[model samples]
Target: MGILTSPIPIQAIKTLCTNCGVRDLCLSIGLSNEDVERLASIVTQRVKIRKGAPLYHAGEPLRSLYAIRYGFFKTTITSEDGREQITGFQMAGEILGIDAISENRHACNALALEDSEVCPIHFPQLERLSHELPSLQSNFNKLLSREIVRDHEMLLLMGNLNADERFAAFLLNLSHRMLSRGYSPHAFVLRMSREDIGSYLGLRLETICRAIARLREMNIVRISGRAVEILNLDALRGLVAGCNRHRQS
Candidate 1:
């Protein structure tokens, strides 16, 4: 049970997107200046979700696509036996709710890992605007494709990588994304907990803790609770490459 707060004004959301620091990484990336202004009109409102709150839940009718303006989220699916699998973690500038485009209903739950703000793009208007703006349409397709590729990578991690390799790759991927957002590549706070990391990586919580400890012992990374510092990025990359070689052989 998560709380949904009142939405910020539509005008506010538009202004935020227009001046957003990471607009290049968001849906507005390639739009012409005029089209970017047009986009401001289509983005409906800024919805605020408190920590531990769900932005949307499984089976909910899909009415909008949300772009994270600030904070983090984890999207998850629950099994028939009640096990929850984390499908993805989202940060600022990433799109959410795309999975529902086909079914018209959300297939998973998106929970805010921290207090967050998101700009909700009304789906109907977005579709209509896409028809008018070729760049917007192309970007939408790329976003969908990127999600598919991310899913494939997750499958690869689960199928081919050992626990240590999996963890290292996860950290590397996070670093890459953070770097793209202009954040420090070697150090950042882990927004999600060990259990959440374990769920996403298909490992037990104890196993995740052990892997983190092992990385620290190897001088590859230093983890103090939720803070992580990559001490030897090359070593982490080597570990990942070694795992890939094992998979290929």
Candidate 2:
């Protein structure tokens, strides 16, 4: 099959327009439109990240916060046993490395699951800017809070839900999120492989495959390689109704 290309048309970028898309997450969140443009001028051009490429790695100095413009990202943390525990996925318009604001090194490995583009907001420059600009501080603070909420949710999901339940809920969550972003809600590409998804959901690779097959058999999902079509969200969410029980063993 031919590669899928981005649909956005090429145009000359003025500072204002480039910051508009990621204002709430990467640039100035609550700043007036004019302030965002002032900040945008300092940012680098959009950088393409190929599939399986590392955007940043664990223990690397947190030189910048990356704002994903398109495609998917998976981050992981390696433990003492050398096992990588999947952290979370970063979608387009989301900020990466926000959690490392206080830390000098990145805590997780960030990898592109598909071809992607990210705009790097250099940390040293941003930190200085933040100290000088009230808008930058407010925006970064808001981003920090958002990251905390997301991480808290991930911790809760991992600590409480079983593999199958977590997988189902994750699919529902992804579908809903993409839909909210005006992307295809039912049909979309899976940027990550089954192994990556399984790791994130705390399931065996084979179990992930089996779960997808089960969803297909139940007419809830149609899966083809990395392409998935959610046939039924209501039924999928039903699989883990009120599954808030944390791991006790």
| Prediction 2 global C-alpha lDDT | 0.74
- Cα misplacement distance, residue 233 of candidate 2 (Å): 1.6
Q: What is the lDDT of every predicted structure here? A: 0.88, 0.74
Candidate 2 segments exceeding 4 Å error? 1-13, 16-26, 131-136, 243-249
- Model 1, 33-96: lDDT tens digits are 6788788887756678899999989999999999898999999999999999998899999999
lDDT of 2 by residue, 1-249 (tens): 112323232232335344455445456656666666556655656567878888888888887887777778899999999998888898887888865666888888888888887767778888888888887788777778877888787787779776666777888878877886677888988877889888888888888877777778778788898888888877777775753322311
Q: What's the TM-score of each model vs. the native? A: 0.94, 0.82
Query: What CA RMSD would you report for each candidate?
Result: 2.7, 5.1
Q: Give me the candidate number with maximum TM-score.
A: 1
Error of 2 at 210 (Å): 2.3
The TM-score that candidate 2 achieves is 0.82
